[model samples]
Each structure stands twice: as C-alpha cells, then as structure tokens.
Target chain A: MKLLESRGLLTLALAGAFLWSLTGVDWGSPLIHTGGGAAARTFFLALFPPDLSPDFLGVALAATWPTLAYAVAGMTVAVLIGIPLGILASGTVVSSPALRLPAALVSRFSLGGLRAIHELVWAVLFVAAFGLSPLAAVLALGLPYGGILGRIYAELLHDVPPEPLRALRTAGASPMRQFLYGRVPLALPDMISYTFYRFECAIRSAAIMSFVGIQGLGYQIQLSLHDLLFRQVWTLLLFMLLLVVLVDQWSSLVRRKLAA
Target chain B: MKVAAVTAPAATQLAAEGIAKSYPGVQALAPISFTVSPGERVALAGPSGSGKTTLLYLLAGLLQPDSGRLCIEGQDLTAMRPGKELARLVGMVHQQFDLVGSLPVVHNVLAGRLGQWSLASSAMSLIWPRERRLAQEALERLGIADKLNQRTSKLSGGEQQRVAIARLMVQSPRIILADEPVSSLDPALAEEMMRLLVELVEDSGKTLIASLHSPYLIKKYCSRVIGLRRGQVQFDLPAAELTEAVLDRLYDLKAERI
Candidate 1:
C-alpha cells in the first residue's frame, strides 16, 4: 500500500510507459502526405475571409433554420423520454425496500443500454430503417440524450437532502407525494440546468445528423468540403456555432430564472 | 369551500408498552412505557443522545420497535400501512422545519393535504395550486399570510418554523410530533413559537409531543415532561413539579458516565 502511495515510483512508472509507447512511431519516415501541408494551410486561411456573398449567405441561413428545427424537435422528444425514466431510475420514489432494488436495476440497465450506443450510430441505424425522414434524426438525438439526461436526473433526485423527504414520510405522505413535494421541487433547479446543457448538445447532435443524409447545416458543410469550397464551409460552420451559442445563452437565462 | 374547512384533529390516545429498539451497536430505547391522553401536550427532554428523537420517531410510526407494542387510538401502530391511514393518525414538524425550499410557501403549506388528494389532482395543483384559500388561511393563522407567494427557502428561520406549523395545521393529524421545533431560534423567538404552538394545539384539541433541549421552554409549553438518559426514562413529572435539583440530576454528567 505504501509503495502504491509513493509519488516518485508512480511518476517513474508513468514516464516509462510513455517512453515505451513512443517507440511504436516511425521517426525516420515522413508522416505527412504530399501536398497535405498546403491543403491544411488553405483550410486555415479560409477561416479568415468566410464566404459572405449574398447567394452563399442565403443558403447558409436556410440551412440554419432546419438545423434549429431538428434540435428543438429532438430535445422535445428527449425531455419526454427522460423525465419519466429518470423518476423510475432514481429508486427513491419506491418505498418498498423489497421492490426498489429490482425496479432500479431494470431502469438502470435500460439507461445504460441507451447511452452505450452513440447518437451517430443510432442516427445511421435510424436512417437505414426510416429512409431519410426528419423523424430519424430526431429519434437519433433523442434516444442517447434521453439516456444521458435520465442518468443525471436520477442522480439528482436521489441526492436531494433527505431531511425534507423524511419529514414528508413521517407526516404520512405516500412515496409518490414525497417525490413530488420534496424531491422534485428541491432538485428542479439543477434538473433544469442540466436539461438546458443537454439541449445545447442536442443542437450539435442534430447538425451532425446531416452526415446520415438529413438536410441541415452539416450536409451543406459536407457539400462545400467535397467541392473544396472551404470559404463556404467556414460560413456554414459559423452558423452552427451561432446556433450553439444562442441556445447556451438562452439556457443560462432560463436557469437563472429557475434558481430565483 | 369544503377544502377550507380546517377540521380540528381527532381526539386520539397514544400508548407504548415495554417498547424498545436497538441498532447495530447501540440501544436507542429500552423498555419504555407511557400513555398520552387525548388533548395532552407532552415534552420529552434530555441530552443529545438521550433517545428523545428515536422515541418520537417510534411514536410517529416512522420506525418500528424490536420488542413490545405501540398503540394509537387503541389500534396496533406497527400494523399501520404508510398511506392515508397512517397520515390521519400522525403528522410531524421536523427540527429543520422541512419546507420544500424552492417552492412557493403556499404550495409547501398545501402539501399537508396530499394524503387526501389523488395523483392527477396533486399533479395539476402544481400548475393551478388548488385550494389556495385553505393554504392562505393556515399561513394567516400563523401570522405569515402576507408571505403566501414567497419562496419558502427565502424566508427567515422564524418564518420558516411558522410555515412548518402552518403545514401541520393544514394536515390536522390526530397527533403532532415535533423534534426540536425551536432549536434554531433566539430566546425571545423560541419562547414566542412555543406559546403559539401550545395555543394552536389547545385550540384545535390535538395532541402534541415534542423533544426539546431547553427545560425552560419545555416547562413553559408542555403540561407534562418526560426526561430520559442513556435511552432510559429518568423521570416523568408535571411541569410545576420540575424543580432545580431535579433538573440538575436529569442533566448530571457524573451519573451519565455510569
């Protein structure tokens, strides 16, 4: 135990592992492809003077609307799926010690299975099954986001101060009443904040859904990249960034209100 | 209009016969026997580890004793289910006065009525806050009606205690159990709260059993005092009979060491 706690020995072991891992790279050969340096330089240079032409701007703005729409639609579904499952997974709402364990285990397993598959993978699977519908993109973002949010919400509900819940219990409140009055109210501010954070993530996820053939900002960016219209790609990237920033700011405002 | 009828708590007797409880390595209570008549105000007083809170929990039906029997209104308390049946018999005011902090004061007060509300109506009350007048009347009785819409967490400590009292009034359980209901208050405020509490219990014809640290407040507010030490009852006496020597013995450190 003392050896494990030693700082010098730990550092030595970490350094040794790093040096051994470095041996796998070939130092004698050129790592970069021919003309790769020039292509990188051009990409970096396009970031400065983004394509601000009226025609290109029109296309970028049009794509931004669909991206925003998809994110909202997806988050609506995520919230719907998240709140109920989160309550079930919390295990605090179930008072019967005999039943709480199995119920919690099942819900925990469900949430884990959901988050284990990434949103991008779900998108591909959904697009394959649904064939290019907007619902596919919404479901893809919603499923994983629901899982992530449910996990967080369950923890929040579980972690509410026990004093209030105990007071409710001895006051003869049922488990569900204790949850609604004690746990949910106390945990609401944090839950709202986390849901807002997840909404921001949903926007990014919705934009990425374009790679699976859904029409949005990511698809436009892909098209510009394929044609090597790097300037237009930068413009499209800015629109995505703007959407994320707006949602983040809006979420922050809502959280402050909730806290108050 | 029916919701606003704050009916007086029912007259109910509480009895404990040779009831004892033990945790992993400590005995929380030992063969304590007592009976509280309806409309009686009793105070359980002792040091920090004197089993007062544990005894109160047992009476509230929050904990079960390992041995002996507890009866409420002549029925077995241990057999009681944790729903409206138990709710009708017991209501508790926490030492911390556990009001839902983020919610409006009205909602926290109204939560006392949840035992009687259906799941759908309770959920809907979050939006519409049904029976607003009853909640307002409870706060008004406690002299905090102006704070009806204020968030519970934002209230002062004294105000929060009043809110807990108001909630109990709305609940109108046959028996009210309080654990240090005035622990966090200043001397004047504590005395004021005790007076108000005693008055409320008397006016409504309800039973009250509170565990308190201060002998003065206990004597001033409660009709009977039950002093405990090391999870055993030391003395059961009337408030007028609580003399200084008896108090010294009750709080004696030398005897406690034994």
Candidate 2:
C-alpha cells in the first residue's frame, strides 16, 4: 500500500512538472501568421484539394533533372565517404577496444551532428558559403546523407553473425580477413538494401533542399505556391511522388533478389 | 579398404596450467590444471554451470584465464591474439550449432578455412572460383555431400551437427574443443555424433576435448573423463573408474549403477 501511494504521488508530481515546463511557450507556428488578428485561417485552407492541373506538367518536367542530379550527387558522395567510416566504426571489423572506441566516437559524433541540422538549414548554410549554385544543394544533401549512411553501415556491420568471426579469430586469420570473409558476406544483402533505401530518402531530401535557388521540383512547388497556382503545385508534388514510388518499387525488387 | 592412418604422436597437443576464472559474485573455475595429448579423446562431464564450457573456451583460446597458461602443439596461446592463426590451431563447435542460418552448408563448412586463406583469396572466392573442392571434401567426410548447397536453416538438428563436424574437418586444427556439441540432439544422434567425433580425433591424431552431460555417451566414446562440480575438478579418471558413487557425488544425485 505504501509503495503504491508513493508511486501515485510521484506520477502526479511528474505531471505537474511537465505542465509547468510548457507554461510560457508559444504554441502557434510562425508559418501561419494571421494579419489583423481576425482569426484568419487562409494557410489552413491553402493546402486544400492539393492543386492538380494539367498545365503544370511542363514546369514539373523542367525541374526533374535538377532534383535527380541533387539526389544522385548527394548519395554518391555519401556512399564514398560513409562505407569506410562505417566499417571502421563497427564492432565487426574493429573488435579491439583501442581501435573501436575512438572510431565509434568519431562516427557517432559526425553522424549525430550532420543529422541534427535539417537539410534545409544545411542548404541555407551552403547558400551563404557557396553562393546561389547547385553545389550548395549537393553539399546540403551530401553532408547529412553521408552521416546517415555511415551510421546505417555501422549497424549492418555490427549485426553479422559472431560465429564466423570467432572461427576466423581462432584460425589466426588477420582482422581484414575476418571482415572480408566473415562480416562482408553476412552483411552484404542488408547493406545493399539499406543503401538503396537511403538513396530513395536522398531523393526526397534533395527535393526539399532546393529552396535556395537550385531549380528542382521543390523550387517549382515553392514558386507555384507563391503565385497561388495550386494546380501547378500539385503537378510538381505528383511528379515528386512518382519518382518516390518508382524508387520504392525498384528497392523492393532489389531487396527481394538479395534476400532470395 | 584402407583405413585413414593416424597422423601424429601423443605429445601434449594441449596443456593448461593452473587455470582460474572469476566473475562478479561467482567463482566459475578455480586453479585447474590439465593436458590433452594428440590422438586422445577426453570428455569433461558435469551439470549446468559446472565450468565445463569455461574450460573449453580457455582451451580453444576463445577466453583468457585470469591466471593460467595455455599451450597448443607447444605454441603458447596465453600470449597469442584471437585471430586466424589461433583459429587454425583450435577448432570449436559451440552447443548452439552456431551455424549462420542464411548461409549454405558449403559456405558454412568453407568458413573454417577462411582463416587459412589470404584476404584477397577469400574475398574473391566469395563469387568467382569458389573453393568447391575444399567444401565438397569437407561435406563428403561428414557424409552430407549432397546437402552442401542447401541452406543451413533447412537442415535437421542432426544434420547441423554433421555440418559442424564437416567444418571442423575442413579446419583440421591441432586441437578440437567442442562445448555441449550434442546436448540438443536426441540420444541416438548424439551417440552417432560422438562416434564420428572420436573417430575423427583418433584418425587425425589431434587432441579432442568435449563437454557432455550424458555419462553413458562419455563412457562409450571418451577413454578419459574429467568431472567438474562447482567450478572445481571433482574427479579426473579413466572411464572405467567412473563408478556410480563418483557419478552421484558429481551430480549430487542418488547412486545408481549404469
């Protein structure tokens, strides 16, 4: 009875603390500011019936190349930089404490810092640094994608079976051999699947990061919205959605093949 | 028909001197000393958590004893790192089968030799010029040559054990340390496995040390039996001396003649 009473009291106290923490915060979003305080709700209705006009298809097509370029460039850089870092960071290849600890710390910090900053924020920084160029968009995607892929690769490396590793260890095989024969074979399928999945995500991130003058689908969407051409916005969105769907299907097929 | 000739002499294949291990609030093994000669098949029999597995790990160079020295084929393992060389010297079959489920039986068997091959050789062998000869030879030895391409998950418990045996055969280590290798199998399959294990040990003239719970199996297969109780050696004697009184004392059960 005493324990139950104490638990209830503790719960009540925690709830009070949570309520207190939210006391002075502004709940409304800055994105939907209403003029004249007349309960204006235009932005709420702005996204209504998501504009689908035939005339906007050309605009959408025009932006496709830039978006695709952003995604491809970003993911390539990510893969190039992430794979080695990830392998080094994982417990599979770097089993020694002296090596694993420092490698893990670096991988974690780099990935965490990259992921913490939104890609849009990264684009803003790149725009400020590199001027209004596609390089800004590419770097924006590349930095975060590299970080995310590195973490994923590390996880894949770590999840391989330990028995093969143990066998390799006992045979007086080198660490590199253990990784190549033992860890690589075990993790190949999952690693490939994850990389493709990340590529799909890169496509989505690439579109969003085009706000700083890289004429991608997202740029078209932003322009159409500013002009209140809801139909054009929907067309751009549909094109983006189509790319996502295509990549999704491709990745599913690849995953199934690898699994088989 | 020609039988496989014994390959080596009984010159201390494995020697452990004054081994001791302790975990937080648990004394797992204490000041144990033992040696296994080439061509000798020794069984360490005990109940759960009796330090049999720990002793196997220590012998296999999988774990370093807090205070002990280990030598396999006159090479010191106490100072050696756990890698390809150590793996080549000692082959271990864990109780859990430890077979990578998604991999084919052949690949699992071939894994035993991965430590011997160069990194480039092993990596390239993953796709092109696969070590078909080595894998087939291993499976053939275990009488599961047809099951080489089959996924390990599809195999029965007995088949998995055979695959493990095949892997050990391919590894061809100087010492074989198996921990509860047949605890999960039925009595018949376990016996068959023990027979194969003993035959392989004797054939290669390599040291074989296995941990088992079944006294009948141990007596039927191993000439020497070491009984451990509560992290200490209770009895180390020939199978003929494993009397009912000693068995009861080791297991703390009522004495009954086998």
Interface RMSD over true interface Cα atoms for each candidate? 1.3, 2.6
- Report the poorest 10 consecutive residues by lDDT, candidate 2 chain A: A36-45
User: lDDT per residue, candidate 2, A94-140, as tens digits?
Assistant: 75668778878887787778878878899899999998788888888
Off by over 4 Å in 1: A1-41, A94-99, B1-12, B253-258
Writing each residue's lDDT as its tens digit, candidate 2 over B19-79 gives 8988888889998888876677788988888999888877877778899787776678876
Give the Cα-based TM-score of candidate 1 against the true structure.
Answer: 0.89
Comparing chain B with the reference, what is the TM-score for each candidate?
0.91, 0.91
Writing each residue's lDDT as its tens digit, candidate 1 over B1-258 gives: 012232445333888999999999999898999888888889888888889999988888888999999988777888877667677788888888977899999888888888788878888898899999998998888889999999888899889988888888888887888888888778988887788778778988888899876778877788888999989999999877887777778788557768
| Residue B22 alpha-carbon offset, candidate 1, angstroms | 1.1
Which parts of model 2 are misplaced by more than 4 Å? A1-18, A21-55, A91-100, A159-164, A188-190, B1-11, B79-85, B147-156, B255-258
Q: Per-model C-alpha lDDT, please? A: 0.86, 0.78
Winner by lDDT: 1
User: What are the clashing pairs of model 1?
Assistant: none
Candidate 1 residue-pair clash tally: 0
Per-prediction count of colliding residue pairs? 0, 15
lDDT of 2 at A68: 86
